[model samples]
Target: MWLEVLLASVLGFVIYWFISRDKEETLPLEDGWWGPGVKSTAKEDESIRPFTVETSDEEINDLHQRIDKFRMTPSLEDSRFHYGFNSNYLKKVVSYWRSKFDWRKQVETLNKYPHFKTKIEGLDIHFIHVKPPQPPAGRSPKPLLMVHGWPGSFYEFYKIIPLLTDPKGHGLSDEHVFEVICPSIPGYGFSEASYKKGFNSVAAARIFYKLMLRLGFQKFYIQGGDWGSLICTNMAQLVPSHVKGLHLNMAFNSRNLSFLTPLLGQRFMGFLGYTEKDVELLYPFKEKIFYNIMRESGYMHIQATKPDTVGCALNDSPVGLAAYILEKFSTWTNSEFRNLEDGGLERKFSLDDLLTNIMIYWTTASIVSSQRFYKENFSHGLGTLKHERLKVFVPTGLAAFPCEILHSPEKWVRSKYCKLISYSYMARGGHFAAFEEPTLLAQDIRKFVALAERQ
Candidate 1:
C-alpha cells in the first residue's frame, strides 16, 4: 500500500510539471568594469555634475575649413542614392553646412534643456534630464529614459521632448506627464568611450539601470530604437521589477519564434495570433522578409566584422563621414528614398537637424568607437548571449511604425514579450520613428503607460 501511494504521487507531480513548464525565467544582473587599464581597487566615485553643451569660434572655424577642403566624387549619371549619396547632392549639403548652418545657434538649442553627467563603472556618463515644466500639486512626473543608437545621439529626442513633458500646450492631454532623459550610448556621443574590450548592449543596459537607481528612481520606463531597443530589452530581462514599462520602435527579433513560423506563418498566422494587418505587412516573404533583410543588412555584416577598417577613411574625411552617416538617414527613413537622386533627405527632416546629428559624431571623433560596438556585440555571434535568450516580462508596448526596415508581427513580438500590453501599427513613419513622428510616438507612449497604470 505504501509503494502504491508513492507511485501515484510521483505521477501526479509529473503531470503538474508539464502544465507549468514555463518557469518565468530571469536574467542574472551581473557586474562589469568598462574603464581603461587595471580595474581600480578604489570604490568608484559617484557624483552627479551639471553639464552644458558648448562650442567655440575655433571649433566652428575648424569645421568650416574642413568643409571648404571637402573633396567630392562624381555620382553615376542618372544614379540616384543607389550608388550611395550622390556627390552632386553632397556638394549642395556641404555648401549649406559651410555657408549657412550656424553651429553656435545649434549649441544653444542643445543647452536649452539641462544636461547632467555622473560617473558609473569608471566612465563619465552624459545624459539630458528634463522635468515637466509644471508638475501636478502633489504628484511626481513619470520618469522615462530614452537612449540613442549608432550614427545617432541624444539629439534625436530633442524634438519629442516638449510633446512628452508639456503635452497640454501641444494640443494633447497631460494625463501622463513625464520627465524625459535622453542618454548618449557610450562611444556614440558625449558619453565616455569604453577602453576595455567586450562592452555590448547588455553591459549598456546594466549601466543605464544603475544610472536610474543612482537618480533615485526605483521604478521607471524605457523607450528606444536601433541599439536603444536592444538595450531596453536587456534591461527588462535583467530587472523586470524595476522597469514599469518597455516601449520600442524596432525589435532585434533575432531569437524570436521566426523559426517556428517563418515560411508558413501566413497560413498558420491566426493560430500564431497574427492579425490581418500582420499578414499584409509581413507577406510576400521573398521580397518583404528575405530580400528586404538581405538588402538592408550589408552595413551590419561589415560593422560586425571590420568596423575600424571602413570607419578609418570615414573619420578622416568630413565628406566621407557625411555620406556614410547620411546614407543611413536617407534609406532608413524610407528605403524607397534610395531611388531618389537627393535621397529624399528633405522629405521629413531639415538639413540643420541632419547635419547636427552628423556633427555630434564628427566633433567628438567617435565614429570608430561607435562602429566598434557592432563588433563587440557580434564578436561572440548573435543570440548567443544569455540576455538574448531571455523573455521580457515587464509591461511591454510596441509602436510598429509601418515603414520600419523590418516588420514584426504581434505574434512574433508576443513570443519574447509575455506581458505585451499594447502594439500599434503606426501610420506615416519609418525606422526613425521618434524623430520623424514625435506627436504620434508620444501618444503611443501615453497609451501604453495608461494601460500599465490600469493594470
Candidate 2:
C-alpha cells in the first residue's frame, strides 16, 4: 500500500510539470551586411572615427534659396492645423527660417558634444558619447544607451544629456551620473542608410547590440521613446543578459488588457494594478484614448504604406519638410497645440531647436530612407515577427508622460516587461519627453537606475 502511494505521488508531480512547463523564449540574434550593393569578401573596417557636423555657406545658401522660392497655399479661413500643417503658419516658419533661424549656430551647438561613427553591419553607425566631467567619489558612472525615434535625431537628447551626465553641475543630485551614448537610428541623421530591403527594428537592434559590445560595454541601461522604444526593447529581448535595465517613455504593445480594461477599469483600476493617476489619464475611453490614436496615426499609416511617394516631395521642398515634421512637434507636444496658430510651437520649444531637428533630415537628405524604416518593419505585418509575442525579462522602467499620443497603464506595461521596477506618471511632458521636459526625464532615469541597481 505504501509503495503504491509513493508511485501515485510521483505520477501526479510528473503530470503537473508537463502541464506547466515554461517556454524559455529568446529573440534570434542574427547578423547581416547592410552595405550598398553586395557583401564584400574583405572584413569591414571596425575603427571608431571622430565625426564633426559641418555646414558650409553653399549648404545654407541652397537651403535659403529653396525656402525663398517655396509657393504659398493659404489656409482655409479659421482652419488651424486640422488639415495637416496650416499653410498660414508655414509661411511664418518659412519667413523665420529664411531670415533669422541660424543653422551655423545650431550646427555648432550640435557639435559641442563628441560625435563618433563606427561601421556596424557594413553601415556607418553615428552616435554621440558624453562622459560625466566629475562623478561622485568612490563610485563609477553608469553607462546608458539613449536612442532617438523617428522625426527625431541625436539632437533630441542634447538638452537632457548635460543633466544626466553632469547632474551636480546642473543643480541636481549626483546620485546617478550617467555616461550617455545617443545614437542616430540608421537612415536618420548622419547614419548611413541600409541599402537592401528587410532592414527592420530587429536588424537595427542586432546592429546596436554589436555596437554596444564594440564600445567596451559588457552590460548597460537602455532607454528610448518612439522607434527608440522598440529598438531598446529589442535589445533587451536579444540579449537580456547584457541589459541591466530597460526604461521607456513609450510602451510597444502586441495587444494586451488595455482594450478590455479601459471601460470597466474606470472604477476597478486599482484592483488591476493601475493607480488613480493611470485611471484619470486613461478614462473617458472613446475620446481621449481611442479618437486620439486614430487622429494622430494618419502619418504612421502613410509612412508604413507609401513612404517613398510622400518622401519624394518632402526631400525636395525644405519648407514642405519643415511643415511636415514640425507639425508633429506641435501636435505630439500637446494635442491642443493643433487648435492654436503657429501650432503653439514656440510656446514650449524655440524655433532654433525645432528647425535644427528638421535640419537633420534635410541636411542628410535621408528623409526617404528614414521613412522606409516604417515600411520595412510593418511591410510584412506585425505578429509575424518573433519579438512581438515575447516578454522582456530584464528590469524595466516607464515614464507615462501625460500628453503622450496614447496612454499606457502600468498593468499593460507589466504584461510585456515581467520585471517592471518603476512606473511613473510623469508630471508634464509629451511624446518628446527628453526634449520637452529634460529635468523630469533625467530625474526619472536616475530613479529607475537606482531601483535597477538594488537588484
Candidate 3:
C-alpha cells in the first residue's frame, strides 16, 4: 500500500509539471495591427515599380479586326438555340459593336481611375484606389474597401465610387464622402493567380489585411457581396481590430441541416409569399440560381479538381472564354433575361461596360485562373467546415436587396453575426448590388458607416 501510494503521487506530480509547463499557441496580433508574422515588402515594390498600363497599337488594331470579323459572321444554330439570339436582331447588335463601340475610349475611361499593382503572398495583386476629390475642411475621408466576386471585376464599383466620393455628381449625398479601394483577388484581373494549390479565402483575408495596413489605414470599413462576402467575413475574423466595421449584401452559413432547415424554411417562405412546403421550395429563385450555377459551373468542377488541364483551353480560345463567362452575367444578374440573345444585359448595363469587364478577363488571360479559386475553396470540402456561429463583436451592417437569390432575415444574420448593428431592406437591386444600383448602394453604405463612426 505504501509503494502504490508513492507511485501514484509521483505520477500526479509529473502530469502537473507537464501541464503547467506546456505553452499555449499564441496568435500573432499585438493590439490591432502588430502581428508577430513578418511584414511583406510588396508595397515597396509597388511604390518603386508602379505597373504601367501597356496598350500596343498593334494589339488594339488586332482586337478591332476580330470584332469586325465576328460582326460579319452569321449566327450559328447553337448560338441561336442556346443563347436565344434572334438572327436579324443579333446582326444589328453586332453591327453596333463593330461600328459604334469604342474600345480606346473605354480604355481611357478605365485609366481615369488610379490603378496600382502590388505583390502579396507570392502573387501580384491589382487594385484601384479612388480618393474623394474634396474633403471637408477638417475631416479626413473615411477609408472603404469594396471587394468584387466571381465573373465581376473592380469595374463593378465604378458607378458607386463616384457616388460615394463625389456625391454632388450622383445627387445622393450632400456632405458624406469616402476614399474607396477596390481590389481584384489574386487570381482575377491583372492580379496574378496562385501558382500553388490550397490558396483559399483565409489567405486572401490575411493579404488584404496587409494591404490596408500598407495603405496607412489603421482602421477601415469593408463591404462586399457574393465571394466578396466570404473574403470580408474572413477579414473580420482574422483581423477584427483593423476591420472597424463590416457590411455585406450576402451571408453564408454552414450550420447543421436539422437546425438550419426550419429557420431557413420560415424565412424563405416569407420571401416567396408562401406559407408551408419543403423549405427549399420557398426559395424558388435561390433554387433556380443554384441549379443554373451547378449546370453552368462545369468549368468550376474541372478547375477545382484539375485546374491545369482546362486552364490551357481557356487560355487559348476566346470564343470558349466568352461563352463560359458571359453566361454567368446572363443568369446571375437577371434570370428572366437568360434566353435573350443579348440576355437583356443592356437593360442594366451598356455593351461597352459589359465588354470592359470581359476585356479585363481577356487581357489578363485569367479565366481559368479565376475559376481555380472556386476549386481551392470548395473542392476540398473546406467550405463544409462545421458551423460555429461567428462571434463578431464589431459593429456590422447588412444591405438586403430585393432580387438577391438568398435573402437572410435580420434574425438569421444576427444568429451568426453577433454584433449586427444596422439592417436595411433595399428597395431595389440584385446580387451585384454595387454595380447594378450604385446610388442606392452608396447611400446605404454612407448611412451605415456614419452610424458606425458614431459608435
Put the candidates in lDDT order, highest first. Answer: 2, 1, 3
Report model 3's TM-score to 2 decimal places: 0.79
What lDDT does the true structure give each of the candidates? 0.85, 0.88, 0.69
Candidate 1 local lDDT, 1-455, one digit each (tens): 55544544464455345323445777789888888887788988888899988888888888888778877778889999877788889988998988898888898888999999988887889999999888856878999999888778899899899998988878888788999988888888889989888989988999999999999989999999999999999889889899999999887766653533546446656744678887787777787778877877888999999999988987877778988999988888887898898999999999999998988898888999999999999998876887777777899999998778888887668767888999999877888887888889988999999999987
Q: Assess the local accuracy of residue 92 in candidate 2 as a C-alpha lDDT between 0 and 100.
A: 77
* Residue pair clashes in candidate 1: none
Q: For each candidate, C-alpha RMSD in Å? A: 6.8, 6.9, 10.7
What does candidate 2 score in Cα RMSD to the true structure? 6.9
lDDT of 3 by residue, 1-455 (tens): 56544554564455345334423221233222122245554443534135545666786666666655553235665453254334444555456655786767888888888888776555677888989887756878888899999889988998888888887666665566789999888888887777776667767777788788878898999999988988888788767778889999887654412223332334434432333332442255445446645545665677678876777766664444554566566556665566666666667877788777877887788887788888878875742532223445568899977666555666556645767888888887777788788878888888888888888
Q: What is the lDDT of residue 134 in candidate 1?
A: 89
Model 1 misplaced regions, further than 4 Å: 1-22, 259-262, 265-272
Per-residue lDDT of 29-137 in model 2, one digit per residue for the tens?
A: 8889898888889988999999999999999999988987888998998889877799987877888888899999998999999999999988999999999898779
Off by over 4 Å in 2: 1-24, 263-273
